[model samples]
Target: MQHYRDDFPILGREVYHRPLVYLDNAATTQKPRCVVEAMTAQYYETNANVHRGVHFLSQRATDLHEGAREAVRRFINARSTAEIVFTRGTTESLNLVASSFGEGFLKAGDEVILSTMEHHSNIVPWQLLRERKGIVLKVIPMDDRGVLDLDAYRALFTDRTRLVSCCHVSNVLGTINPVAEMARIAHDAGAYFLVDGAQSVPHFPVDVQALNCDFLVFSGHKIYGPTGIGVLYGKEALLDKMPPYQGGGEMIARVTFERTTYERLPFKFEAGTPDYVGTHGLAAALDYVSAIGMERIAAHEDDLTRHCMERLSCEIEGIRLFGEAPAKTSVVAFNVGHLHPMDLGTLLDRLGIAIRTGHHCAQPLMARCGVEGMARASFALYNTREEVDTFVDALRRVVRMF
Candidate 1:
């Protein structure tokens, strides 16, 4: 962990006279030096609007930008680069599918299934579709342990069930949903399956084809890449059938006074100027993670997470932990007795410890657990056991205060 910690220069900074302890990884990860350097290199070396210009710099920029798309395709193991579309982030990617796929295939009274553990990005888009298209939004029930009830999910699918959208890994609960099984079930019901991979992609390996999902979306920043860059991977056929998400220069084939046609596959959905530099930085981040190996990262984080839970449970009194599923990522969400999460978070910040405290954008999940909010500490591969120990010692101070 120390070897890779150098890659993230910000990790060395001080907060409130104490070492900065970054536990808000579920929100967004700090960028590695390679990722930032890549962005700088792109801006200095090949800064030009992609696909619009035919000059030397433009062609070079276009190649670099499109090459990033290929990197994304390979990262997710998609069939072709044509299946990948770049967006501002996961929110925009999910919105693209909700708007375009809904208009093309979904009808009035159709059903789109979701889970209680979903981030707001997964929930709101379908709700928008419901308001505009009269579609029914059904939620898959989850147990108190923060795991989804597959029996309830199977029951929710009827003839009207046109799509099933769910998270691969929950941002709040850290529950790793069984997307492969869910995709199989959706396919059996003749429904397309979409996965919000914002949390999962950062933690472990996720092959889009292996999951057998129709669409998958993830943000680059969550995976140590630059912000404002994300990937939306739909099956080529599905993306082709769906209409353009937005309209502008690159998405158009040839504009005529009478009729206009959209560009093919990826560009059809990507309207206006694309984030070429960010995409290049994202590719660099992907390369960095690949060099580290997801399996090794996953194993290291698991040990840290287990240590964190043990320390929090054993060292602290009257604390309640949320999302205790057997299968989960390196996220800890909990609260001490009668202490407001915001207050706890503030105290922790004063101690130079950073953790997220709130409903975690899943109000329904918080409601399900009979709480307003919980403080969360999410671990990344670069995190260390020593840091976890320091965090626990600081938490002890927080408890003593209350």
Candidate 2:
């Protein structure tokens, strides 16, 4: 309900002699001042490695670092900090699960079910496991509207299906998947479920327990935090059963030439020096968003999404909008006439409008949609209806030239 236009300093910046209209939020959000200041303050005050030294600075830094872990646990409503493992980003988090979970639970003949709309992060890790461990990967089909074919998805699972992993919201389509039902379907088939919450986390309230997913991953940068930090949430029993993703000094309890033992719970998966400053930034970002409230943010974004869609549809003739699902988030994927997405995007940039154009790292989804690429204008809490007006007008200008 509140307008936070000034919270982000980057919005004041001009591009190509025009006011900046930043709509490429699905790629990465612009950081708030609080997030930037928090990371800066952490380095200036508490700059020491966690769980390593015994001195005052180390103890103080460790507390701040561990406090961040608790903040992330509370952000997603996770059961405990033990279930949250920090990684570089969503990609690394998914890779950790693929490498550790694959080694522990998957065998030669096991199957993993994924959706066609998954980002490359979710797809590549499983493909790597297939190549390394001989695991079979099946894709859940989606319709032209970018909605997943749920009936077909259910049929893809067999007794060999060891895991069912899908995105909570499609980064390209913006279709919010029915993950709770899908999780139940996987459970009925005796399979564990994982949800990629990268696109969903910043915009809405997400409860890992309510979804009944064994694992969930999301990136902090997408949620207005600093880059190179992500959270991986796994059920305690499952994470405890899986092996460590990488072996290093911090993750170890004892080291010997004969044998070495690993640390417990969260630390076991987080090897080497953790990003303490970035963790602080993430916590600050969560606090910033929470102050505004997720429900309010989601509602504002939904209104903006519909407004942008209506303007584009009514003003621009022959504008083909992708992802027309009844239930969707704030992304609008469209290609105007025969104008190539890249050409349209380049011209729009000259007008000081930023929009993502291409396959959006989901080549499979692009192929399924029967397009080489598309121009995506995604909204965030800080984005505005005025910026949306500027974007649509600029898009019209770009289309006229081509």
TM-scores of the models, in the order given? 0.99, 0.99
- List candidate 2 stretches off by more than 4 Å: none
Candidate 2 at residue 113, lDDT?
Answer: 94
User: How do the residues 174-249 of candidate 1 rate in per-residue lDDT, one tens digit apiece?
Assistant: 8999999999999999999999999999888999999999999999999999889999999998899999989888
Q: Candidate 2, after superposition: displacement of residue 260 in Å? A: 0.9
Candidate 2 local lDDT, 221-261, one digit each (tens):
99999999999999999999999999987898999999999
Residue pairs that clash (backbone atoms under 3 angstroms), model 1: none
- TM-score, candidate number 1: 0.99
Question: How far out, in Å, is residue 52 in model 2?
Answer: 1.5
Q: Residue 395's C-alpha lDDT in candidate 1?
A: 89
Alpha carbon deviation, residue 357, candidate 2 (Å): 0.7
Assess candidate 2 and give its TM-score to the true structure.
0.99
